[model samples]
Target chain A: MVEPLRHVTPFWPAFWRGFRALMPLWLGIIPFAVAYAVTARAAGLGVGETQLMSLTVFAGASQFAAAGLFAGGASAWGIVATTFLLNARHVLYGLSLARQVPLTRPERVLAAQFLTDEAYGVTVVHGAREPGGLSFGFLLGAELSLYAVWNAATFAGALAGAVLPDPAALGVGVVFPLAFLGLLVPLLVDRKAVIVALASGLGAWGLSRVLPGGLVVLLAGVGGALLGAVLVTRRGEA
Target chain B: MSVPLVTLLMWLVTYPARLLGLSLGRLKLPPFWLAFLRFVPVSVFAALIVPDVLGSPEWPRRLVGCAVGVGLMWRTRNLALGILGGFGAYWLARLAGL
Candidate 1:
């Protein structure tokens, strides 16, 4: 069955609004791509393999996990398994977005390729303010802008990684954590958020040593959320 | 199997996850579940960043980068400035032969 557009907004306004909405995200996105490509390169992936992964794979956490696991001498099957498990959340994201966005089949197929945590967040928030729940043009703009920046940044990093005598000598590796930190810092607004962040950060730091790469993320995310819940209920809201 | 096929395999693993979810008829998640998910991004980012910044063998350099990044982010609330400062600080530290 074909779904109709939810609202009557003009295409250009919605599209440009979607494009403009993600401008703040480019900071995290750019450094993120650079960090991943350089990491993949330092892990001994060929420039072609590194660029291809960003072009096709496009999931940050999985790409990072694969690079780290590859560096640790993981088998190909193991890496692919990790990729699937890490990406399982995208399933939830799509379900949520589809109900909100009203995408037709072809659009859903195209949209699925660019779906990620940031894309989902921006679109949902932007959609909420629209007269209807969502707009196709807005989503198109957001997804395409993000897709363009992410790939361009990734390819630049790959080329830079290939040419740099030592990516380490230039501190390329620091971009990963710092880039992530840049995104996370603004969100630490309350005790609950702070607790969740600390708990997850410490949990990840500890769990990473014992568990496989993907498991650390899952367990830490749950642990942090659970801790935040407990803290929220234990005390009155500020 | 050829090794360069790994990225293709990664695509195979990921694409269907989203496609399948989108195919599901309009579904409404429970309220509590939605509330809980509000914390996912912060937790996930922290979880991902901590191990990378602190657990890596290159912690000292990453720590410097993060310190600068956080300091600038705190002062400016500007994502671009904070990230660029972090990169510059890291580069300077490395250039100084740290």
Candidate 2:
């Protein structure tokens, strides 16, 4: 019965589905990438270096941090240290997604290059819906589209330079939070998920007032996940 | 100190964390750990977003955009439309000088 459905939908179809699934996320991604480009350029990075940073570093928050530090006349080592501290959440993301999508070392290495918060969110949501687990084709499709959009937006912003106006002034900065709200709505399917999400959100916001950098998010997420696991185990035993 | 060297160092510090879990994929995690991992996607996203929604500049406009976004997603369950609605609301608020 399911055989025909499986045969009809091949690897390419899954890949395309992944691409299309990420289309909505472009709302936030476009503005953020453009902001990074404009900020990097304004911070005295040449066009080549600005583009290179987007292409290689690929982490949005860290890129913004690095650009700000550079513009402030911080030392190279200072910029690197600050950016590294801001990106430590990626380790948590990688750990969460590692088992969900099994792949060989080489493929994993390649995929790691494209693992942004947005990519991971979309991949895991899609994975949960499909019984067969996460596919490499789907991951590739989603990541590649995000990567392409980010790089292109960066280039456009860099080329436009100061003429582009501030993305924030135009209300573009709201797109990220709005887009995330959209993503979060669909994931709240049960009591446990809601508790975990709410706890994590509140914890992060509270900790951000006192702590520095990305550690707030990482610690909050870990705490929420641990709480969720215990709740699930208790429910199961009941 | 050079731009290229700095870029290389940035990549070195960042990419390792992204790749570490994949390299350790062969190790089997306990069931409790796996259950915990399942909640991570939502937790991570919530952690990323809530701060911005609560603390963004131009509080009134951002609040309106967020309300519209959540309302649209709740009513329609369409991600693109919800985002577009939020973007439109934000632009409207800005245009109104809010």
Query: Is model 1 an incorrect, acceptable, medium or high docking prediction?
Result: medium
* Prediction 2 TM-score vs. true: 0.91
Model 2 lDDT tens row, A60-165:
8888888887788889998888777777778777887777676667878998898888888888777767546577777778888898999999999889988987
lDDT of 2: 0.81
Model 1, span A37-109: residue lDDT tens: 8888888888788888888888988998899888888899989999998887676567656766766789788
Q: What would the TM-scores of all predictions be?
A: 0.77, 0.91
Per-model lDDT: 0.77, 0.81
In Å, residue A174's CA in model 2 sits off its true spot by 0.7
- For all candidates in order, state the fraction of native interface contacts they contain: 0.66, 0.69
Best by TM-score: 2
lDDT accuracy of residue A4 in candidate 1: 48
- Structural similarity of chain A in candidate 1, as TM-score: 0.72
Per-residue lDDT value at B64 in model 1:
83
